[model samples]
Target chain A: MSAPKTTRAWILSNPPTDMPDESTFKLVEQDLSELKDGEVLVKTTYLSNDPAQRGWIQKGVIADRMYFPPVEINAPMSSFGIATVIESKAADFPKGTLVNCLTNWREYAVIDTTLGAPYVTRVDPIPGFKETHFLGALGLTGVTAYHGLENVNVTKDDTVVVSGAAGATGSMVVQIAKKIIGCKRVVGIAGTADKCKWVESLGADVCINYRDADFKEQLIKQTEGYVEVYFDNVGGEILDLMLARVKRFGRVSACGSISEYNNSSPPGFKNWFEVIANRITIKGLIVLDAGARWPEMIKEISEAAVSGKIQVGDANETIVPTAFEDVPKTWLKLFEGANTGKLITHIV
Target chain B: MSAPKTTRAWILSNPPTDMPDESTFKLVEQDLSELKDGEVLVKTTYLSNDPAQRGWIQKGVIADRMYFPPVEINAPMSSFGIATVIESKAADFPKGTLVNCLTNWREYAVIDTTLGAPYVTRVDPIPGFKETHFLGALGLTGVTAYHGLENVNVTKDDTVVVSGAAGATGSMVVQIAKKIIGCKRVVGIAGTADKCKWVESLGADVCINYRDADFKEQLIKQTEGYVEVYFDNVGGEILDLMLARVKRFGRVSACGSISEYNNSSPPGFKNWFEVIANRITIKGLIVLDAGARWPEMIKEISEAAVSGKIQVGDANETIVPTAFEDVPKTWLKLFEGANTGKLITHIV
Candidate 1:
């Protein structure tokens, strides 16, 4: 197949001070250059819009010492997604190969396989699963939940509480904690009643809508005021509340702080003393660090899916597909809580 | 020896919201009751005042699910101190036994050894050491520092930062981390220049006064912006600041939060997201939980002291002696940073 002459891409124009808007990115047409040795020209299939993107685009203090370096000004925004290699100089990733990698917000991207522009891994499409499943249940999202729970040594004796339970990573955490880990109870926290119901359907014993007037009271009642493990995705009032709600010797997996990503100045924790009083242990995690263990995570998740222990329904049900031009809008939807699970942009 | 018919004690009159004051406690004379089986009448010699008492006096949400139950209204304020058993019905604590136990702010206390009013352990007074040594270097304060540092596995490779570095536990931490653990570097944080100098005198490589306008910058410069382990004695802005200052995969031992102890609504951490970004691990500790390991800690500390590896100077230098009737005022001094080291009420 002949390489495409031009590619349309979205570049970060102005960094967002608070919530990102249309002005945060600029869509442009870029001319493609010939691929170098050990580089592959990949046709982007899907673009992932994750809450983590908000942190990556930040500048100054917020961007300092971050896990991933901030996206440079006027650089193509990056996402973890699916792509098809059409032309390649690299032996590992040849033509007609389906791979998952850190893809740019462009239709065609040249991936340096040898130098490793982030990373490139060839993924075998599961027979019954959609391609987007590799970005959700069987990918980094799944690995994050799996490794964090493992890090904390969550067991069947634990009553697990997961924040952002309706989102992709959180939904997987809910299922994995309940079905695979066999935790005594799995309680989820979501933003809306519908999201709560969806989280409950995904094997959470109960899901509390955090927007309720008596949300904390409800959490106290459901978990009996003693959560053994808390998988925190939202950092703000919820994180503080969980600190107070957890029992003595509680373990916290600090996954993501989606709630505070948009805020320039995030609020501090008021119930932090509970950490000392209860002898709690809070650990932060980054899924990218678990690259070596991805195969293991994928194997277990695939087996569970095959056995109907996890992903009982359509794995693609949670993926909200958006047009490529509307990628920035779809990314903004994450903060607005518009998309239920995973939000993906399908290139036309 | 016959027990006294009456005893003077300080009781919690009202819980303070921001800071404990003169009116927060009441001194009263109580009629002593006859000793029962397994009970010993103890004459309080020295009362150890701690920042933890501020948390113990809190009511409502702040006191909820605390490791130690809150001091009840009108109940005697408790502390760890030295006492001499004058009269006893307990075989374990015969008359004239010098012991260390949870003592009230009073001249005399009746201890039920078998029932274990908190706990009572016979502390053999070292021939060359002052009796107050048992309350500082050889007591819970030292144990807190030793165990917390050990809990985080602070090794020679670690560059440790300790908050409240001039206070009892903090001073011990500075000495132990540097002289015993032999860490690469030990940085201390205190409120004033004199306290910082005192902290540095205790084997800390450098001590920064947190009150300085460029305190954070000073900490960054001193530690090269990468602290491997943080022994957090003060929680609030400093805790949040250290979260950002620590290296990736850094370990934090949450020993105490003297900064937030008196605040009814303690401030939240603005830099809390650093936990997720850096993959930090924060573990809370309670010295009371390390009872079984006390012998191990005490032996190591004793050996270190004798070898001049820890407590090289006069062990009693940090003990700020006050009159028994002024116990509450002595405790208030802890928040004001009035006392240089350990504040103890010397009963006349």
Candidate 2:
């Protein structure tokens, strides 16, 4: 079989503005390179659009120095994607296999899976679920949610408050906490009114819009009792606010700080003293540390999905497959808070 | 037995300046009160002068809350003390039984043991070592160090960094970590050159003075690798400095923040971002939480002491039996940093 001469992809031509705009990324066509020995050629099936992707493209110092090598000018930008192994010389993976491969936002690419950090795994398609679920509920976001809840040892009686509740990880957290642990109350804080409703639909007992004028007061009133476990996804002000309401011996799982990721200046909390007064236990976790237990997590999430106990929104839920050329535009939509659930691109 | 008609005690008539003067505390004589059922009358035997007590009185705050009850204009002040059960109506504790009691700063006190928090049990002469060890190495301070280390899971391969290395809890932590875990290296940060030497003698691989202008730089240099465990006793800037050098998955047992306890406006760290990037875990612990494990900790400290693996500093080793009227004056010495090691008063 002959490979296509050209492939479509999006490149970050400029850094994002206050709110990322379509101009930030430029769609382009590039010549496809032939696969070398020990390499596998793949075609993007589902491109995962996540909030964290916004930070990866920004030009600034991050707390953990978590910036990707600056997105080169006019080059296909990299991201987590579910791709199909069209051809392979690797022993473990065979051609024509549906695999969840984290790669660039391009229609096709050649990868030396043996050397690349983006792990590629064979996907066993589950009935009634779209391949995109692998980009979400069955993927990194789901595992992260599971790890946070498990690491903090969230229980049924725990009053868990999740920030960024409508985001991928946060949404998964709410569903897992409510369905798996049967938490007494699951509160969600999202950026928009619609996001709040979506979080509530995910079994959150209460959902608050952080954009509300009286957000702090309303949050305190809703969570009148002290918070037992705070699953922090969006940090900065929300984290500081939650710190004040944490009960004695409370646990805080620092999963992500999306709020501060794009801030021009470092944000500081004025009431960190609560960490001492209440004897709160705050722990930071990266999903890589949870790799040791990923298989177990995948099994649990798969069972939950099969039993219909965990809802992953909808399967046919599709955003118009933005061309690889439109990766920047699709990313801008995410930053503008226009996309709900997961955003993916179907490579031609 | 006829009790004395007048008992001598010390009362804090007014809050003192930088260092408390003898005149700041008033010595007075008062008539003894009758003991009730379930009550034991005790004479002060070993009055523990701890740095925490200084913070309590000087700032009127302990653990971020008001510590002082109004002085009532002219009555004696109450404080924690180790006393002997001179007269008792309680069955468990009989008259002439040596007990570690919490009492007022008076020659004698009628205490209902049921209403007080127990500090220690009736032991056989507390060995030939100073009975004051019961207040330091074998008592609350020692237990605090034990719980912090155990809860944080400090291991042999871990690099342990402890602040307030010369103070009661700090000194105990350095010794316990060195002797019990066989940690790769134990670094201590103290306030004075002399205290640094004391910490070094306690088996601290490196002891740096926080008073130095290049304190933060020196701390980074000393902890050339990464800090795996940090036992924080002095919180403010020193805690911030250590926080910056903590490696991924580092654990911080926040025992106390002595530096900020006295400051009217406590300074905060700007680099809390490290908590996320490095995946550090910060836990605040009060020794009371480790209630059932007190005996275990005492056994461990005792073994280390008996084995000559750890040495208690000699700066404040002097034990004097003084009338209760001297407590306020003696406590003032702790505030002035004039006394070292563990300062205790024996009841004659």
Candidate 3:
């Protein structure tokens, strides 16, 4: 098939003061320019929706000082996505070959493979594993879980606690901590009962609902006293509670703060003194910082998936098929906790 | 000399809701017990007053969960002190020998050296070094400084920041980070101009007065932007501010929180998110945790002290000839930032 003459693209119209809504972005149809000698024309197939997207559209110093530059206003918002090359000039990307690249919210676009990393990457589909696994368990989400636990040097004797355990990275952490690392106990925290059950199904010893009135008591009773390591995905009050529950010389991997991303002033940590009293160690993580080690992480995660030690099936993912007009609305579901597991958008 | 038939002691009358005051303790004369086998009768010569003593008397869970048991009500308050043995039944501690041990506020007391560690340890005075050095730079205060920096893995390339730079542990940290570790830049924070000067005299590159209206600006300007390591002695707002100034992957040695010890509700950490955003690593330190490594640390610090590489003289100490009736009042000075360097009470 020949490349389309026109494409529909969504651009960041305005940065969000809080959570983004439909008005945060504007959609427009633009005439496609010809591909360069080393570029390939591709059609967007699958788009990955992440909580980190909120950080990209945030205003002021937080957005400016991020690991990667903020998505420029009036420019197409970008994230990891799968695309099928429809026309190509690069020998590495032939026609009809599927690839995972930094894709914008556009129906059709051109990728310059010559630019190398942080732009285009070739992903080979493995037999019996769905292509969507590349965007979930074997993708950045999986690597984030793998490396964050490794960074804190989690041991098999550790009693681990994982927050946001139903979410993408948290789900992977729960499985890896229990099934792979064989931690003595793995307790998960999620927003709803269904999500808690789902997390428990993913190899967690127990999953507590943070909304439960007795959440704190349940956490204490379930962990049998204190936690050895805390893999935190949701920050704010939950983090404070965990700080109080962690054992002396415990470790905390501050991976994400999804609970506070949209808040202008997140709740402060009152239990911070516990850090001094208990001699705890806390380290923050940005998965992109481990770009060089991605190959090793992916290899281990892939082997686990093939051996069925780690579940990377539909139960571990939430893929919503979206019409060209509903992309923004579908992405907003992430903030509302409307989906479980890794949320992916199938462009129909 | 003969052992006294009666001894005067100060015991905790009640736990203070805020900072401890003169009313917190009651002085009483108690009849002395005979020294048993493996025991020695000693006279208190010097008392080391520390900010951590406040934590030892704090009420509720904080006090209950401390590394050691809290100073019980109506019990003599305990701290590190230097004593000279007068009468001995123990083979190791002969008459007229000086030693460092955990001692209560008493003019005379009996110690069973058989209990060993945390109770009594022999200290050999080095030539040309004041016995007070064992309470300041050569004591727990100095080991705290050496091990705290070591626990965070501070390197020569580090631009280090030390809060409470004029206090005992802080002063030692300033000297070690600058003269021993040879950090690229060492900035200190103190409450007064004279204390700032004292810290600067101890090899700090620059010492900023936290009382300065432009303290934050001066810190940023003096450090040339960001800090690589922060050894926090005073927590609360200063910790929050330093959290903002630390560079990506920066390390924080959470040594002490003197500023918040008296407050029923300490100020929460508002910039806690910076921990995740900057990928910072914060580890709380309790020097007792490094007991196994103290001999090595002391050996190195002693070598440095003898070589004039580290300052362990009167210039780094504040020895107050405190009267028997004024022990409680002198210790309150730590909260006021009234004393510079190590505050030692010379019991005449």
| Residue-level lDDT tens digits of model 2 in A1-348 | 776667777777777524567776777787877777767788887777766666566654343444234455566676878777888888766788776765677788776777632267767788877778887887778898999998888989899999988777888899899997799999999889988887888899989998899999989897786789999987778887898777888999988776665554444554455575567899987666676688888778878888989887562133546655566666655555555566666554
Question: Which number leads on lDDT?
Answer: 3
How far does residue A180 in candidate 3 sit from its true spot (Å)?
A: 2.0
Candidate with top DockQ is 1
Predict model 2's lDDT versus the native: 0.73
Question: Model 1 over residues A173-244: C-alpha lDDT tens digits?
Answer: 998999998999999999999989888878999999999999978988987858899999998989988988
Docking class of 1: medium
Q: Residue A30, candidate 3: how far off, in angstroms?
A: 5.8
Per-residue CA lDDT of model 2 for B164-251, tens digit only, reads: 8877788888888998778889999987898899888888999999889998889989987678999998777777777778887889
Local lDDT at A77 for model 1: 92
State the fnat of candidate 1 relative to the true structure. 0.77
Q: Report clash pairs, candidate 2.
A: B316-B340, B316-B341
- Stretches off by above 4 angstroms in model 1 are A61-64, A115-118, A312-323, B61-64, B91-94, B115-118, B312-324
Per-model TM values vs. the true structure: 0.94, 0.77, 0.90
As for lDDT, the candidate ahead, 1 or 2, is 1
Pitting candidate 1 against candidate 3, the one with the higher TM-score is: 1
Question: Alpha carbon lDDT of residue B115, candidate 2?
Answer: 59
Q: Is candidate 2 or candidate 3 better by DockQ?
A: 3
lDDT of 2 at A115: 60
The CAPRI-style docking tier of model 3 reads acceptable
